[model samples]
Target: MNTPTSTHCLDWSSKPSFKPRILALAIATAFASELMAAQDSTTADKTNVQDDLVIYGGTYRNTATKTALSAEETPQGYSVIDQEELTMRNADSVATALRYSTGVNTELRGGAVTRLDLFTIRGFINYQNSYDGLQLLFNDWNLQPQIDAKALEQVEVFKGPTSTLYGSMPPGGMVNLISKKPQQDATHSIELATGSHSKKEASFDSTGQIGDSDVSYRVIGLAREQDSQADTAGDKRTLIAPSIDWQVSDKTLINFNLYYQDDPEMGIYSTLPAAGMFRDNPNGRFDQNSFSGDKNWNAYEREVTLLGYKVNHQFNDNWTLLHNARYMDATAYQENTYTSYLDTDMRTLHRRAYLTNETSETITIDNQLSGVIQTGAIEHNLLLGMDYQKLTSDIRYEDNAIAALDLFKRNNSLVDRNTLDMTDTIYSSDFTKKFEQTGVYLQDQMKIDQLVLIAGVRYDDYKGSESGKKYGVSTDTELTEEHVSGRIGALYQLDSGFAPFVSYAESYQPETGVTRNNEEFEPSTGKQWEAGVKYSAQDGRLSGSLVAYQITKDNVPTRDPNGSPYDLIQAGEVESKGIELELNAQISNNLMLSAFYSRQDVEVTKDNNGLQGKTPVWTPEQTLSIWANYDIYTGTLAGTTLGYGIRHIGKAQMDAMNTDTVPSATLMDLSVGYDLAGLSTAASGASVRLSVNNLFDKESYSCYDSNNCWFGAERTVEASLKYDF
Candidate 1:
């Protein structure tokens, strides 16, 4: 592990020198008088998997890089969860799809009750998820809206800071979900599924040319309803999305997309006391699926809608332009009885009732210009882009204390809402807030024979304002901030199919409080230095990477270790050093495997909160995961297949103090299915698969604090039947 000082001194902002010769050539090519002259070599060379599907390791356009590069050709370390992987695992959520991917820990906080995609990348939690490379937003800002897994073509995860391409994000990493687009080839599919907890689901997808007039369209929809592992907990959801692509002219193309979702049965995710989960409790331990809240008064519902559009234009073979715009709205309403306290005896827990409503609206726009040119002895791939986002939210709430409950004598009966003390319920707050951010970036990838160099820079301006009534008093607050971030990397290709790479990156995120000197605190900043080796096979059967990095974050906001909540400081620092190994291989004629391992040491070097050297909760030091699937090619079971997967998470301390520990556990999963390849024409492409998760029914717990502890998943079984045309 490199010292923290090394990361900050790497001078990641350094830029490479390029020539105006290529710029002059690019301009000449763009202004060529030939209107319909043949297409250039650079036209439509977009690294899109949808354009050319990949069954094994293949090409990809990392939105993070803004340039299409093969896995081994890129300097940054990343992971890709493709469609084949999604199908083999029968994953239905974004978190589940990336469960085996490295640098990710999807604990599924609150489990089936809340159904929020809760996870951490590296050692930090960030909400910078993107849909088709654009930020995803919800009208209801309190909860994350889970995207239907089927709607995604792939999920790309880039580890470490990426503020150079994007803007204002956590230092750990980000997840970018690529949405399925309209396909030129005609295709249609339908699937039906049933599983434990009376789970029932149906999905339909269709894509093809409307009339062969240079236009394509696609539509996808699904409906799902399922009970939970816990008593009286379940959820129902419906989703529909449609998209269209049109080549209006030889030089211009446009695409549009729309998505909507509704949830009628959202429940409060369940939680328990850390004492009852990690250590011996004065009272008896509660069962893993115990329901500790009022069942009747817990009412929750949410809805989301999104619309987006993209335009691409080619001025000539060497120059291209792209513009994308999106709008999203989300709303949520809830009235619930929630757990509020665990008494000194650890046997008594308090409850509370609340009614809340929230709504959020967001609009984003992104534009980029790309050009290909050659200067002297080097070829340059250049990209210049700009993005702007505006978000607004409204929140309202009222709450009151509710009756207490004793764990020893459990009550399964629902609590009547009318019985609560309504007098104690008063308006907590009603407010509206608006935020806006704009960013501009420039990047270039230049190649000189076996050596590839990448450099990029970005600038961002952010502003926010809040206004509303609090306790019948008008309140208002406004903030403005700006930041500059950058990155540089170099890669060398070897004759032995090995590539060595080194890179440095930086990022910044705004803080919310003022320093002790009465001036606003400076934004938190992060810097990282990484080196690694990448591998790819000429036969396209294997691809993998081994990467090591040291990252440090400064100006972290800390509560006055000895003062009140209003008293805060920002002179804190933390560092993380780790190595990650991942690989995907088509090992044999009938077998495939994917594996990953990660080891990291994250610590707070300086802090005012008395956690100077403590490791935060939920971040394990080591993790290992493997998944393998095999097909039968001979005998009567020729069309049958089997798959297995396992993941092990090391011990995680319950809190920063390390007083309690969450024991390590290994989880297992199994899947079996039969392909109808030799069946009659009508059923030729039909298939059925059965999946059993948590094969051993192992039990475990996870927590980030003493107040919020989560129980791991239990046994689950599901079967799916699908027909294709």
Candidate 2:
């Protein structure tokens, strides 16, 4: 087994904490008592499977069960962030949109890597995303596609394993982004904004029926540019989304969509040595805004285009058929120089430059048939689904050793591309990978009075092939695997709006490529056991949930102990157990609140390395967020709105051996908005908003692995002006 050098560091332990558990149990008990007393009250009608809108403040239909299920009915953890919430927070990216969600670790790379979505959920990395229930094209390389927040209607978060409906995924769960479709009602808006770091942006959205025809159209576009914290680095983006919805007949409807995004400059996305960011150095700490790369050589360019359509057909009042499909083409080119290692003096550093050009093409399709039937007192909602996905990616890259630098000196060793010699640089890799998967699934939801039971099973066949040279080695590899996933859950809804639920689910992820002996890699499998209780007020004013879950993943690939550097063996296992609490409330006609708390304990249960029983990097033990907004309804300041939020990220281990630590950090945010219509008769549909993140500008580190460390985002301010017509 390969053993990493152990260093003297923090004594942070991975044991589960009991204080939060006790508090959650006590709160649940108190709520149960109060709810039981109101059991005599009236109850709500059963959920309609076709309802795609939100129910009970925060709910969705197609996220967890592929059918309509309210927050209090679904046997899993779920959260939805609507357009209103997004606007209130001025969220521009998916990571920022999910900043306060439960069981999610956003901005693990701090504010860098804006061109990609890189974060953790339930102690596992989950960069894959779904758009309108279809998976986006993502590969192991740098070709990440970023979806604009202005084009989304809502973002839904599903926590825990969901492989029964979705084909292949991690046990941590999935994120689904709902797009903004065409509407019959005419709506037009334009927005302009400017913020710190010379940021500038403009956006527009228009939707309406086309000349009173059966078809409606929507067009959304945005342009943005901003300077980064890293010296001589900046970002520029352009995006456009167009869609059309047609009512073919009383029983059939179709929607077509096209999305295009381009990023000409995505800024430098690299890390600094831990010696200056987390640990003490002889030369003192490094600046958070330090740049370790040559500005003239750093480059990041990307483009993504996707076209898709959705169809819904109703055969009768009890049966419906739905189909969705999308094709995506994405490309990225990157050049970056990063720190390799710090010298013994802790002031001199070695660097390496890497360059890559990659392109990926992906096609995904999903078909589902849903029906409702009743036998005696039992009601059944059945769903039969089939989904297919194919992805082909081509990548070429080169790596070269770069000149060293003095950590405390200023621009003493900058590389000039015009004068530098590239004779020593070598092309390192050129490869192509193709993957295909087909999944067939069946699910049944049965309801008998207050009890709801859900059961589902899915079978997936997946294959992968790779060819070409890898670091000077020529090879051709193929791997094919098949697996069956299942899920079962039970929930009992009481008349008082209190529901208790329990569920079990299984998931599998195929590993690409082959081992040293030319053996096909085995797929990793995960299983989870989850239980939770949810409550919704009868008045629809409040909703809350408390959940506990444990997930185990096996067949994980680890480095082969006795083989060469690039060898691997599938003999590792990991376990994650956690508890989460969430609440959303409309306190009054003019006030709203949202909050969540999560704590997790993760460990490497089995591994060939000496990392067994240790916590992984970037996995924090606890996270908490609270946000509130207030609107003045009847006063001199009646047109004003105020918002405040607090977020806390707990300590985390820096290495697989559990040595070194990244200290906890707490940040504050503030926002203000006003309706300009109240100021003058001519400004009827105008409004303005201002928001500041990290209000105190607290300096902190997001993560510090043994090699690299990341600094969290500094304070940022954004102001926007919008007009509606």
For each candidate in the order shown, give its overall lDDT on alpha carbons: 0.71, 0.77
Total clashing pairs in model 2: 0
- lDDT accuracy of residue 614 in candidate 2: 82
Q: List clash counts for every candidate, in order.
A: 3, 0
Among all windows of ten consecutive residues in candidate 1, which has the lowest summed lDDT? Answer: 1-10
What is the Cα-based TM-score of model 1? 0.89
| Pairs of colliding residues, candidate 2 | none
Top-scoring candidate (TM-score): 2
Give the lDDT of residue 187 in candidate 1: 96
Compared with the true structure, what per-residue lDDT tens digits does model 1 show for residues 1-725? 00111111111010111122243234334433232243233424322222221221111236657656555667887888888778888888887787798878785353555445657778766644788767774222354566879898888898888888878677888888887878777999999999988999999999988885667788999999988666676778899999887655655556788999998776555466777666779776767677666676666688888888776666656766666778778787776654566798787877666666777777776676777789999988888888777777776766677667776676745466667654423436577766677788999988999998999999987766556753344546566888899999999998777899999999877664344344566677999999999988888798889999998999765434354222456647878889999988999989999899988888889876677887766678888999998999888777788999998988887765677778888999999988877454466889899998888988877875565677777778999999888
How would you encode candidate 2's per-residue C-alpha lDDT over 444-534 as one tens digit per residue? 9899999999999999977777777765677677777789999999999999888999999998888876666776666778999999999
Q: In model 1, how many backbone clashes occur?
A: 3
Candidate 2 deviant stretches above 4 angstroms: 1-61, 418-427, 515-519, 558-571
Predicted model with the maximum lDDT: 2
